[model samples]
Target chain A: MRPLRRLVLAIPALWLFAFFLAPFALVAKISVSRPLVAQPPYEPVFSLADGWQGLWDKLSRLTLDAYALVFSDDLYLDAYLSSLRLAAIATLLTLLIGFPLAHAMTRAPRQWRTALVLLAIAPFWTSFLIRIYAWIMILKDEGLLNHALLSLGLIHAPLSIFATEAAVLIGIVYSYLPFMVLPLYTALEKQDPALLEAAADLGATPLRAFWRITCPLAWPGIFAGLLLVFIPAVGEFVIPDLLGGSDTLMIGRSLWNEFFENRDWPAASAVAIVLLAILIVPLVLHERQQVKERAA
Target chain B: MKRGLQPFHLAVLALGFGFLYVPIALLVLYSFNASRLVTVWGGFSTHWYEALLGNEALLASAFVSLRVALVSSVLATILGTMAAFALVRFGRFSGRTLFAGALYAPLVMPEVIIGLSLLLLFVGLGIDRGFWTIVAGHTTLGLCFVTVVVQARLATFDRSLEEAAMDLGATPLATFRAVTLPLIAPAMLAGCLLAFTLSLDDFVIASFTSGPGSTTLPMRIYAQVRLGVTPEVNAISTLLIGFVGFILLGAAAINRLRKPQGSG
Candidate 1:
């Protein structure tokens, strides 16, 4: 490339290197270091200020106690499992709800389709914190739902829905519904209707046609929506923090508590590394799929 | 081929929209509640909104968030636009894969990991955690969104105009300045708006990076909401929702206007 073009690429390239890629390297380094009680709260296992020999010496002496603790402890294991389970469940729920909504959008009048799409995605552009906060208001005991239920004489008392696992699930589904619907909508909308009509003309039932034609075509959308919701939902912090009960354990929340509440930077870094390892599998698979799709 | 709307589809649409919007509508409704109790509506009043105006800490944090969003979004847009140009125009280059990975990873990476990792990097470098640190963190996050937006626009871009400009003896830089910049300006603006909203809405990253006095509005909201729900928070959230909603609607309108007829 010419010098000007090289310069254009180098600026962002260098910025990402320094800010994005380098941070993970730091996290990996810190995860192997010892936690301390001093300022910054971690023993520096390797430092650039040290000479190559000294750096080699420190690196050789680095401890894996943080990772050991993360593995040996059931708390960390449960947190990881819980996070994965919750994310999986939320992804499934979102798909179930999103698929029909996306289908409905594709079937709507062409003039109304754009407006409907806008309505569906508009909430996402608003503050995420506010959206979750909105749930807190609605789900709390004596909140709107309970108030309405009681006024209608449906129940004798308010339901204690706030700060529960169910509430967290509700929050996740609500917050991530758009992420699920948009991709599914895109995928569903692109499919040729003639294929489905041809199936019906061949005497196949609507259900059979949907299963054979629609579902197969929507697989890409399903996969995309699943990852889009599952990946972030696994690492979600604010939703569970605000909506979940005290006993709720998520890897993201665990990492936050380890770093801020306990001030154990090394432990927190270890948890983060493990979480990244788990997420990398799906992310890499998704990348390979995208590359394959592009090539095709 | 037009399919008539079925009752099942109508029900699905109604229930789906209801699930998505009922909570927000309730929150907006209760923001004007006269009662201190959120659930019990005494009468329609704007007392909570008035109270928000007088809260000093909230106002201070709002100012901080606005400033951070402005600076970081602008920085993100410039760098992101350049990155988009590199990706679209420069077909193959050394480190292209790595560059693309780094740019797109932040979009899917969880905020906590990003926050924690960035904080550790700042601490490792002996840099103080404050306004600038938050800016750096947000700029990293925002630039990715900007890049995605601008990249989409660039992919479908018409290059004939630029070729024509070059054929007329306009230098590459001159052509870019006169033709390319104006054409992609809308996408860049959209990207900047997206970045601004991301920065403003961010809480976890700001909490991790902020020092003594650099609390953003989301951080402030999180702190208060954790203590307990209050009408004042409802008021602030309602205002933010309204502001962001207006901006998004405006963006959609602009996007619609920019499209060629019958294309959308």
Candidate 2:
């Protein structure tokens, strides 16, 4: 019994330890290192030839320059702030769009439920890169959207909203709408028909019933969906990079540029560490929500 | 029960579905466009599809992405199923909390942090960053999802059936094989499908972990899109989307077939 249990325990533990936990420790280690012109582009923690002298030298040379650089620069700061602003607004928009759709799915006939669920998840199977790419096609000048609006007589000229913050918002909302709806639908689906009926019977209007009954009942889903959208959206790189113009300053893009374009490993690691640090709060809350769901 | 679904809810859902699908529809529609300009609708042609056959880089990347998705998803499913089993069946062992913590952490960790950290780990360990590294990276990201899905399925399972198998003189492993594995096969497949698509669609992590020769489909698409929109991208994307759609349909059909097996 014990050996079998031990074998069961060892596999996942070793894998996570080697792959997940160790990598994070390396990230933390590299964030404090100095960037150099050498291969790998970061100074080693120590050299074995110098023995204790090298250890002391490494300790002395491990400066917080990367941390200082990120703090000193307004580009990273603005990126963080803008990412937060964008993620927050996008989360709200996802909720507004997802709630009704999810509610409708819950209320849908049983046979149609599968179809609705498939419809919801169908796009997720497709390439995310492509979905965002599709938006570029739609929103570009002389694109389908502008052509339609032009023909519809909605406006005299094409609205050049592409490459703007609004486009980024659209991309985020479009991409993450499913995340919001799936959880919300799951929570809303578990609602008792009796509860809503009782509220309606007790002189509550439909809107009032939804507010008092459905909203409160679906709080867990709302919270789950919010965290799901917000955390990823905050660190979202692809959407803002592809859809956004030069005016947009998002941290994920900045991190990419810092690493790839600048080849500054330490600086990029510091940016990532700080991004993780700021995002740690919601990440924990999300874990807590998952635990609660599992427990329930 | 007087269940009244508001007209507003139905409309909103319709709009949401429209919003979700129209871009995809447009991409499919334009993949056949005779015009080089993505926006202009030329008469239908199969030229872009022909063009895709000649692009070696895109073809190679697509092949690499498929291989990586297949390998990583199979690996992730096994590992994640083990993690799920441990969480569900192992019962209050030491470091269980830590195990649970590690299991859930990747689900929410930002791709940049995950990607950057793992890349650094590879460089630090002197491991080559290419196909295998991507498989490792994807498994790390995807295992959590599989664990979650399998764990949910396990939570609803009937433990007494396993007991019944045990009572029939079957060993624990046998019981699991005969009883548990069959019961949870659908969910496990679903989890694997999830992992596969995740690996298929992953751009950020693959970008960070992948070295020169292992460009995936997303990486290729990203590079192409960066150069600006082209009908070739539309054609390729349309094909990829069609492939995924087929997978989903197969899964749904399999699920429908499984229901009768479960009942009988």
| Per-candidate alpha-carbon RMSD to the true structure | 2.2, 1.6
Residue B53 miss distance in model 2 (angstroms)? 0.6
Candidate 1 per-residue C-alpha lDDT over B1-264 given as tens digits, one digit per residue, 9 for 90 to 100: 236578888999999999999888888888899999988889999999999888999999999999999999999999999898887789877777778778877877889999998998899888999999999999999998888788888888899989999999999889999888878888898899989999999999999899999989999999999888788888999899888878877887987786674244
Number of the top candidate by TM-score? 2
Give the range of the ten consecutive residues with the poorest summed lDDT in model 1 chain B.
Answer: B255-264
Name the weakest run of 10 consecutive residues (lDDT summed) in model 2 chain A. A44-53
TM-score of each: 0.96, 0.97
- Candidate 2 per-residue C-alpha lDDT over B122-195 given as tens digits, one digit per residue, 9 for 90 to 100: 89978889999999999987889999999999998889999999999999889888899999888889989999
DockQ of each: 0.69, 0.72
The recovered share of true contacts, given per candidate in order, is: 0.71, 0.72
Tell me the deviation in Å of residue B4 in model 2. Answer: 3.0
